[model samples]
Target: MVRCYKCGRKMKYIRGLKFNQYAVDGWKCGDCGEVYYDADQAQRILLLNKLKKQKFRLKLNQVRSNLILRIPKEVGEAMGLRNGSEIEFSLKDDDKIIIST
Candidate 1:
């Protein structure tokens, strides 16, 4: 069963494809419009997901098990995070985050 990469919904398998560089499959998400460029990536992710569903996965659910952040006190003050205020944590790309706290 094919699932949308972004939306966790069952997707209709339109076709298997071999693009200029990779093997892929076309799937349309009912809730979102994110098209996967490489189906191999999706399949790999789905395998892990299936393992989790089966209660057989035992992996850290993070990019890093122990992440570290060291910002100067002045910098934290400048960002108005010195008073225990909440801050937003946003993804910088696909692999990093910018926590403004």
Candidate 2:
């Protein structure tokens, strides 16, 4: 049971995206609309923010029947992604795209 610092209301437990990647348990105050994460979740959010701030330029290559988007070595290593790791692609809008593992 957590309390909202701003509105002094009881916080409700909710599951939300931790870093736009993983799901995490957090608290949200109904009255003030404030959100709070636990220690581990907060750390994950910080790491994710840092990762998101990093910029990587990649090139696309032509495969036999399809186009392949090359993932940089540094980015793959930092994200702990392997060569055969499974990933998901999402198109948010006309131009924006998101990829996750």
Scored by lDDT, the top model is 2
lDDT of 2 by residue, 1-101 (tens): 89999999999989773545667788989888898877677665566667678887778898898989988765676566897898999999999889988
lDDT, model 1: 0.56
User: In model 1, what lDDT does residue 91 have?
Assistant: 92
Model 2 spans > 4 angstroms off = 1-49
RMSD of each: 17.4, 6.8
Candidate 1, residues 18-62: lDDT per residue as tens digits? 444445567666678655545565555455444435422224344
Clashing residue pairs in candidate 1, if any? none
Model 1 CA RMSD to the hidden true structure, in angstroms: 17.4
Over 4 Å off in model 1, which ranges?
Answer: 1-68
